[model samples]
Target: MNIIQQKKDERTRVVYIHIPFCTNKCFYCDFNSYVLKDQPVMDYLRALDREMEMTVQAQPPGSISSIFVGGGTPTVLKPDEMQFFLNSVRKHFPDWDENIEFSMEANPGTTDLEKLSVMREGGVNRVSFGVQAFQNELLSGIGRIHNTDDVYRSLENARAAGFQNMSIDLMFGLPNQTVDMLSESVTKALELGLPHYSIYSLKVEENTLFHTMYQKNQLPLPDEEDELNMYLLLMNRMSEAGYRQYEISNFSKPGYESRHNMAYWLNEDYYGLGAGAHGYIGRQRHVNVKGVNPYIEAVNQGLPRLNTLDIPREEAMEDFLMVGLRVLDGISRARFEQQFGASMDQTFAAPLEKLVHAGLLDTTDEGYKLSSKGILFGNDVFGEFIGSLTGN
Candidate 1:
């Protein structure tokens, strides 16, 4: 902690707000969200406002650099609800950076011109639509309500509403999905020439309909080779098309990277507001109550946090390595040293040496980054640092 380092530490905060209501939940999804029908929508918004007030009162906030509204499909909110929710955000966290990257996660078919117009006026400068895939069959099989037409209409509506910094999500591995199918999806996605794309392999997390089918050997997922090919194809395609693989699953044109996600990869402190949202600040992290009713009730009493934990220094170091490496540019040695007040070389010498020796990690003049091969086998590369210091 020298004077200059202290001066540099005054970085702005990132904000994540969760709206856990969806018109419908996709089968492969396990996010903390519920069906929108008959829910106490207005009550939840008010509860969210109260939670935000309490949160700022406790720790306060610096100028907000990014605000990402995610989950269940934030655009599912009606025009009026959207206005109130956005108003709550401005009321509590008014200090916005002039160039703040305010992003809202939208689902196709859930947004119309009117809804999007409300969002743009509410300080949202970016919108990411979850298109998942271009083919109608894959979308239907996955229980998504939106079709290819809906995706087009949604993007057109967003653009019509004065949005240019938009992004879309595409999925790779899924039941009965082929390499050709994925290739087709990629082709269609790139054709739009959007500023950003986030393509991910399916993980079939527990508690999802897909997970249940997997248990019964009913989930006909793509074979490993096909999945590998899909990943490789996307990497090559995005690169050739002039998009940077900013992070493992995300691609964007120069300067179009999602700043909110960058905050997570850098393991920086961010305010996570709303039900089931997670926030980390100063080595302490809190998860809000997951259920909408439970969250609203909790907020009426006080902060709606389900639990808060002080992240141990060793675990935090491991996390720093895990998340930072996801970025193509990798982590910085100076950052590690400044945050932990220790040399990265001395802290995890053996693991670093091992990974670099295996060609999974490469040493940069400033720090370390994943090698070209390391990108494909990222899970394995990250695994090496999981317990570098702590036995677990």
Candidate 2:
């Protein structure tokens, strides 16, 4: 069925806007993004505006609980461009929940006071800075143009612009990064006293410079043991600092958890707009056209959807288990029955029993959750559920 002609579901409460332009690409990064130089920025924004108009008219969202503008570097947009883009959003998603969490991803060097002021006035309440590491050498080593000073300056500017609910992304296990270096970075991050922090281990995905370097034995990533140690050390540090490990890689002060991301972890439907974005609605998941010009041209006629697939009930059940287990609280048994119309235990007794016997999973009153030992070996636990239902 044509995606546009398909019946619209009003369950979507989260909106994700993807800005595909970046100042430069990082070596270890593989997200869908383009360098900003000589690109048709305004045309892309117009395309996005058209997509928003067509989308809400088709499906009209439920009261939007959260709006996340992520990307190549959302803050890289000029102030006027930001205004136009934000105005387009306000036009379509006029009614929002009282406590809407509007967040935008920014790079340290790209956000200045004026651009931040534009964001603030446009109703962006949260700012997430991509401050990958605090060390200048490591920053350069990872192909980041921003330095330590830019991180400090960006935070100061964000605060001056009246953003309190802010988060900074930190990465560990980089090339030539040491435990002490990571410790220092964590100390500096904690000292900021921000509401949220996301520290992720580096993954060398295909098509990235890091992957090519890895293939050539040129990337100097930490060994498996050191990487594991790094993860353990950060988990302990964040706990000691009074931050809750709400998800495996996310820590937050009480009540400051990222609601938009939580919607994702809970496997809820959301609107994904802009080039190369993915969306889930009803039972179908869709990916938008990837290339900039192609996406813009496609949306000019209709939706820019490149492909759509209806997720089978078993696959959705597997996805629910895999994604929900990322949260510390785990999935709820009642919610699973409500969503899939089957008992969780009845659906996959074999995998659940195996995981429980291996001490990788434990039962809660609400449902089953990952055990303390299971947290470190999460992929193994999630793997147990995949293909277990269909025996494929």
State which candidate has the highest lDDT. 2
Per-residue lDDT of 1-392 in model 1, one digit per residue for the tens? 88865553474378899999999989999899999999999999999999889988887777889999998989889999999999999999898888999999999899999999999999999999999998899999999988999999999999999999999999999888898888899899999989999999999999999999999999998889989999999999899999999899999999999999999999999988888899999899999999999999999999988899999999999999999999989989999998999898889889889989989998989899999999999999889888778888
Off by over 4 Å in 1: 1-12
What is the TM-score of each predicted model, taking all chains together?
0.97, 0.97
**RMSD, each candidate, Å?**
2.1, 3.5
lDDT scores in order: 0.92, 0.93
Q: After superposition, how far is residue 18 of candidate 2 from its true place, in Å?
A: 0.3
TM-score of the candidate numbered 1? 0.97
Candidate 2 Cα deviation (angstroms), residue 304: 0.3
TM-score, model 2 to reference: 0.97
